[model samples]
Target: MGTPAISGDPKPQITFQTKGITKVYDTGDVQVHALRGVDLALYEGEFAVLLGPSGSGKSTLLNILGGLDQPTDGQVWFRNQELTAASERELTRYRRDNVGFVFQFYNLVPSLTARENVELVTEIARSPMDAREALDIVGLKERVDHFPAQLSGGEQQRVAIARAIAKRPDVLLCDEPTGALDSQTGVIVLEAIERVNAELGTTTAVITHNASIADMAHRVVSFADGAIARVVVNDARKPARDITW
Candidate 1:
């Protein structure tokens, strides 16, 4: 069976392509290979999970795909644009305009209210959703005026999700988004991410070591020793609320 469609568009086009991608970090005395001869593709409006052990290169691949880092060798294409060939300024513009990122940490300004924190991105975005609308989508409408300190871990992560989606990015890249939370709170954060990907049709890639989380992905890419070890296409997907680690 084919992977079940989370978005109505089942046969969406490719959003990103990597050909023989490799990333090596030279530490003067030694070199660390983060990715080696990796080839991958992510489809538009798809939710893909990167699954692996710690230091298996999942986060490194995600970082490269999101334009945070470039491959030392080979090519990366974000749609028709060759990201590997883009200048630093162009990469910055691409990130600002087309990509949204969420990390394990909420990264909210402690001094700002939830709405104000989201407004920081919407104000700079060329065409953005209203901060309130974004918050509402993430189920944070009631917490708009609350500061980060006033919210729970899950709620703060939801606010971060809201801030990320307020710009209506083409791709949402999340790195261990629930790593800091307990199981129950992590489920809530995953629910918010699920809502964003399903409702907004953002091409989302999430890196997590939790193998159980793979059930929610349309496709799961497993990493091992700086290479993609396996790629699984799920015949059916469970909603985040239905998933349990």
Candidate 2:
């Protein structure tokens, strides 16, 4: 099925046509190879999971795809544009206009209410939903007026999620978004993300340390030693709360 973003206009077909994509970092004389010829294709509206250990380079690959980092070799094409060689200014514009990010911590503004914190991004986006609407999407309507300090960790993370989706980002990049919460709370956060991915049909990519989270993805990619060790295709995905070790 087509994504929610495939509305009036045609949604640009999303795919990776990498012949060989590699990332390398030079620390003085030492060299670290983060990615070794990653050739992968993630279609539009796909909910994909990436799992790996700390140094396995899953996050590195995600960063490159999001334009936060560039690969050392090969090309990354997001539709028609080549991201790997994009100028810094272009990368900034691409990030601001097309991508939404969710980190492990909820970096909400302490002084602003949940609505206002979300409003901060809505105000600057080219075209964005109202802050109230975004909050409602995450099932946080009642908590909209609460300040960050007044809410629980799960609530705060939901607010952050609301802010990210308000802009209608084409791609949602989440990095260990539930790592700080207990399993119960984390499931709530994951449910919020799942709802967004399913409802909004954002091309969602989540990087997680928890192996169980893979059960919810359409495709689960496991990284080992900077390479894809195994890819599991799930015919049926359980919700976050229903998944177990």
Model 2, span 1-245: residue lDDT tens? 22222223255356544547899999989999999988776667778899988899888988988888888898898867888778999999998888889888999999999999999888889999989999998889999999999999999999999999999998899998988988888898899999998898898899997999999997788989888888887767888779654
The numbered model that scores best in TM-score is 1
How many clashes (backbone atoms < 3 Å, residues ≥3 apart in a chain or on different chains) does model 2 have? 0
Candidate 1 lDDT, 10-128, residue by residue in tens: 66788998999999999999999989999898998899999999988888888888889988999999999999999999999999999999999999999999999999999989899
Model 2: clashing residue pairs? none
User: What TM-score does prediction 2 earn?
Assistant: 0.91
Question: What Cα-based lDDT does every candidate model obtain?
Answer: 0.91, 0.85
Candidate 2 achieves a global lDDT of: 0.85
